[model samples]
Target: MENTATRLADIHANIARACKQARRKPEDVTLIAVSKTHEAPAIQPLIDAGQRVFGENRVQEAQGKWPALREAHPDIALHLIGQLQSNKAEEAVALFDAIHSLDRPSLLTALARAMDKAGRQVPCFVQVNIGDEAQKGGCPISELPAFLAEARAAAIPLAGLMCIPPADTEAAPFFAYLAKLAADNGVAGGLSMGMSGDYETAVMLGATHVRVGSALFGVRG
Candidate 1:
């Protein structure tokens, strides 16, 4: 198997190529390695290779993996990128640096209560259902402005916005839309869009952070 250092260099090369194609500075886009379902053994070498930010899809999975990995590598940042249950809000708040799937008021309320109880403020991104897919778990685009207003009223730090484009859609326009929304909201950080498949397009469209899994780690078992 290729060592973590080799894999990281390869991934960085890919990011640089993508940035060149997108006409963006290589530093403008941040790569967030998605470490869901994989264990710490799989991640440690990557940490050693200097990857600090990771995205996890499930709260339970992250809760299990983070403690040990954190003990070993205290600076790693964990982001929650999956749909969050209100019941899991407290643990999620405690474990993740940022939650990227705050889609409803109930979830926000739960996170607020959890933060209050923990006495720690957590940054969060509002997931926008740009594709308007009924099966997806993001808030409707039309409801975003009001949602932001409400979140602001509640003193929740609205870090930025995240979205997943339709599977068949070209990712650039969707990513551009997200960048536009972030600009409109006056929040200049945290556009957590794009994945391994279309991250190059995402970089061109000004993605601040791109979640790359298979491209970095190979296919998950």
Candidate 2:
């Protein structure tokens, strides 16, 4: 197996190549290595290799592994890439630098209150259920207007939009549509889209941030 540094280098190379194909600069895309379910010891090598941004699936799990890690690696940025419960809003605000699952009005309200209480405003991406999947957690397409308005009114800083295109499906059209939604909604921040399998196509279609897991860390065993 490739060492962490070698794998990190390879992913950077792929991002660079993808940026070239899109006629975009490599710096324009942010890579959040999804470290969910991976142990802390396994993560240090990548941190040692200078990979700062990481994504986590749950607040409690993140709290468990990250406190000590961030203490040792203060510059590391933690992003919440999973569904956020309203009850965890305060903890989430205290822990994550950014959140990618601001999908509902209740969560929006909770986050707003938490941000105010914490006296810290963290950037958040409003997750869009672009595929209208029944099992997914995102604001339905028709609800975007009201949902976005609620988010802004509550003073939550917006970081554009986020979506998970249907698995095993052609993702380009969904990416393109997401880009259009962001533009129409006047979002000036990043589009959090694509995972390990389709990040290159996402970058081409205007994804500003890619969440990569297995490609960088190998399959989640």
Please give the lDDT score at residue 43 for candidate 2. Answer: 90
Among the numbered candidates, top TM-score falls to 2
Error of 1 at 218 (Å): 0.6
TM-score of each: 0.93, 0.98
lDDT tens digits by residue: candidate 1, 1-221: 77678877887887798888878788877789998878888888789889999999999888887898888788888899999999999999889998899989999899989999998889999999988899999989888888888888878877789999999878888899888888887765778898989987787777878898887787755
Candidate 2 residue lDDT tens string, 167-194: 9999999999999999898888899998
Model 2: runs farther than 4 Å from truth?
none
Quality of model 1 by C-alpha lDDT: 0.86
Clashing pairs in 1: none
